[model samples]
Target: MNSNVKVIEEKILSNNWYVLKKITFDYRNQSGEWQTQAREAYDRGNGAVILLYNADNQTVVLTEQFRMPTYINGNETGMLIEACAGLLDKDNPEACIRRETEEETGYRIGEVQKVFEAYMSPGSVTEILYFFVAEYSKSMKINEGGGAEHEQENIEVLEIPFKRALEMIETGEIKDGKTIMLLQYAQIKGLL
Candidate 1:
């Protein structure tokens, strides 16, 4: 609690699986004025995303799944191609991404490089996502991963050429933010 800021109140808007809250606060502006503001924050918890690639094969592993939020918001099919990712329930970011890689893409990843962390939607979401990159080989595939059956995740695995995956970004196929950032990072770092 800085002296310049004070929390006025927090009201819960929803508490089903996660929480959504309306927060009211007052801030002492630099102009020597106090200002009150209200903002809604959705707390779905933090998550980790990893881009699995094969330098030898010049390819990357990706997954496609239906997203309800995207669908409701005018993504006609609601299907998005993205890197392997999942919520960080109790595990650390690296452990979470490794587990998600195997669960969603069927590749047991090792030697992952943590690239960066980002607030995906800073204005209204409290999710700080950890981004990573890892190398994968065919031998790492232990099972045909479609995510946890109990969670009803119908994910499709894709092994796309690195160059083609980049092209998808221009053609509007790979629209997921985390995936795009990781892909662009790969391009910038010459990982592929």
Candidate 2:
């Protein structure tokens, strides 16, 4: 059996926050026959998601934003309800989550607990999502979460009661896979 696969060619598709690539690889099958396959793959920088909870107010913060991809795919409402998240550029996952949490919700979390690490879309993308949970005091305020100007993100931060957030999940208001998974995980682990 051959265990090595060689890349024949690689091409860049997009060069934004995430880069898409087309790659052709040559490999040998179990039958000892050689073959070449081409595929479009995504090269996403490391990412972080923070489940911000306001302990005093018994509320959780979520963001709603217009996602063009989701709108074009199937969702009638392009707005996605999700935790504060972003891609890591120069910082580690933990630092990235903390920074994003502050940028997206104005909450400066002191200690963040890592929940899990996962692949957002494993089939074709190389994006690894680091999930975290942080407790914030009720005094934490939402100044304005409109993302970085360079990225052109228009973010709306929503501070809803924990129960209401769960209700939104149950009613399909939150359709993002990562958000759903994190919320469900928190519920199962009694973190929410």
TM-score list, all predictions: 0.98, 0.87
Deviation (Å) of 49 in candidate 2: 0.6
Q: Which stretches of candidate 1 lie above 4 Å from their native place?
A: none
- Which 10 residues in a row give candidate 2 its minimum summed lDDT? 138-147
Shift of residue 92 alpha carbon in model 2, Å: 0.5
Report the C-alpha lDDT of model 2 over 76-144, residue by residue, as the tens digit: 879899999998987999999987887777777788999889988887998899999888774555556
Global CA lDDT computed for model 2 = 0.83
lDDT tens digits by residue: candidate 1, 1-192 = 599888999999999989999999999999989999999999999999999999999999999999999999989999999999999998999999988888899999779999999999999999999999999999999999999888899999999999999999999999999999999999999999
